[model samples]
Target: MSSTLVVGKVVCITGSSRGIGRACAIEFAKHGATGLVLHYFGDDETTKEIQTLKQEIEGTYSPAKVTTIPGDIADPKTATTIINAGVSAFGRIDVLVSNAGICPFAEFLTMPQATWERTRQVNLDGSFYVTQAAANQMKNQTPQGGSIIGISSISALVGGEYQCHYTPTKAAILSLMQSCAVALGKYNIRANALLPGTIATDINKEDLSDDAKREGMIKRTCLGRLGQPDDLAGPAVFLASDLAKYVTGASLLVDGGLFVNLQ
Candidate 1:
């Protein structure tokens, strides 16, 4: 049997300029993904990073093509743009990693309505729109199948003191995957959630910079350390590969045992 996972497959990963998305993009290429469609929020810094990432991946993995799209995930049209670009470049999209999101920590009572609304629009609503577009493409394709990996968080299962608005969006993403699994299974499309636990990424850099907070999360993990973005790459690969063909509506916690270490 071929040991390579996702060979010749085309993958679309949102927020792939950095963090978990970046790690997954590189891993997928290393494991034989033939094409990559990377999405990022339209900012000069991220735009540059995605371009560099495209060069690095394509150069390192010869013959593997990469397409970068810059847009706000909060806008529904961004999702449409990403899918169309992927299909135009690769003929089909075999996998989608819905990983673009934000977490602006704030106390519940004092949080601004704008904060709550923006988080909802990006995290929850964005995932729905992107997943829907991907699922629709997967359904109508010749093979009639694809895999979706939603980057949810452990906050979906537990609450955060300062993440009242953010947590709900993550939970909703988890629920969205569950429903998509049911709705898309008949078409051979698999939907699953990858709930990461405090993975060290740009998203939580300042929050983790606090010695007390950082150390506390590290100690809480059974692994004795915080998770790196690369930690979730393997699970993501498995889910996107045939290894997880039977896995759908499942929530895989890549937390370094943090969720189970509650004691």
Candidate 2:
């Protein structure tokens, strides 16, 4: 049987230069999303990487038209720029993956107010701003609806030793996704959150590198492993595709069954 390709769909992913964001970009391209707005932030080296990623996607995959937008999602204006870049390039946005975020390990006592505020700015406020911008465009589009995906984490449901600030922001994102689901449903837009567990991404480099911590995590996970960036691609694709047409205000956990180990 032939598979249905999202050939005409446009997907905008924040923090698409590397890790899970980059993986989602490639996954979307592989599945035939015609227009892609890859969002990222950082220095010249990072910019070049994103450019290369764009090239790779267009060349290796289905030749999906890829555009790169760079900015800090913490800035509301940056969020506007991201959504506008996609609309301006594709004429419409069919799905949005609000995936840009930061998580630095800091003890609550030692973590300054600056760090806490910055975490909130990027994780919670940023998701809010980006979702607002995307929802606005989605509502105004001729077809009048799209998918809004919030990239949350397992820490959102369970507290972490050093993520006092980081965990709350992710929890807020889940609530925000639910809010968007109810508010935007009238316009046919759906909102949902994806929670990834112990993914071996750059953000977790320090933790994952430790033998004991790594072994502990692996042991806790029923799947007996840490998740890879590509592990999230399938779920992200489903949330952004018609397969999830009736799914909204839901949080899907992609954590290798670790959560159930809450003993």
Candidate 3:
């Protein structure tokens, strides 16, 4: 594929202020995406990060416009605002990355209702809302097509001791992509899932802080190291680019072989 696979394209990514989403945002700009709509949670820390990200992208990748929107992904209205912002600024959205999510580690038996519901609302419900909005825009746009990438996790395929509430949401994201792929094929709108395994992100910072536990995870990967957010950025770029024109309803694992390291 060419270096500028996504050149001239406009991309939107939710939860782009940090973690995998942040890395993907930078990669997209480097790959020649002309416009970026970055969605972030409206918190002081993330708000600052989003501002910094905007400057970094626009400064480094000159002419690549960046628009940052702060919102609660779990709120359905937020999805509308994000998609609309992209269209208003860039004319149309060529790629949608439903990456906003939360995973509060807790045991299933003792998990509070609020924690479970919040997880589902943000991870699953948020994806549904954003994807629906983007699909509609893509369907009615001049080009009449776009790529939708859902950020899922290896937990979708396997169970985690403290991720019972979380895994279901990730699993739902994968299923949503599969269904969307079939539903939007005629419109040329591709939907797919990217599942990462044990990526070193804020969500798992405390969990990985334990040296022994972190080492255990690293040992499980064939790469002999924990996955980094940048590790998933290349796969994300491919999915959004013409390189993956024929790819839809697919689940690409960017797990550094951890998923297959069963012993």
Writing each residue's lDDT as its tens digit, candidate 2 over 17-45 gives: 88999999888888879899989996797
Q: Tell me which of candidates 2 and 3 scores higher on TM-score.
A: 3
Residues 1-263, candidate 1: write the lDDT tens digits: 12379899999999999999999999999889999999999799998899899999988986689999999999999999999999999999999999999998899999999999999999999999999999999999998899999999999999999999999999999999999999999999999999999999988998999999999999999999999998988899999999898999999998989999978
Q: Tell me which of candidates 1 and 3 scores higher on lDDT.
A: 3
Candidate that scores best on lDDT: 3
Each prediction's whole-model lDDT (CA) = 0.94, 0.91, 0.94
User: What are the per-residue Cα lDDT tens digits for candidate 3 across 119-164?
Assistant: 9999999999999999999999997999999999999999999999
Q: What is the TM-score of each candidate against the true structure?
A: 0.98, 0.97, 0.99
How many times do residue backbones clash in model 2?
0
For model 2 the local lDDT of residue 20 reads 94
Instruction: By lDDT, rank the candidates, best first.
Output: 3, 1, 2
Order the numbered candidates by TM-score, best leading. Answer: 3, 1, 2
What clash pairs does model 2 have?
none
Error of 1 at 199 (Å): 0.7
Q: Least accurate stretch of 10 residues (summed lDDT) in model 3?
A: 1-10
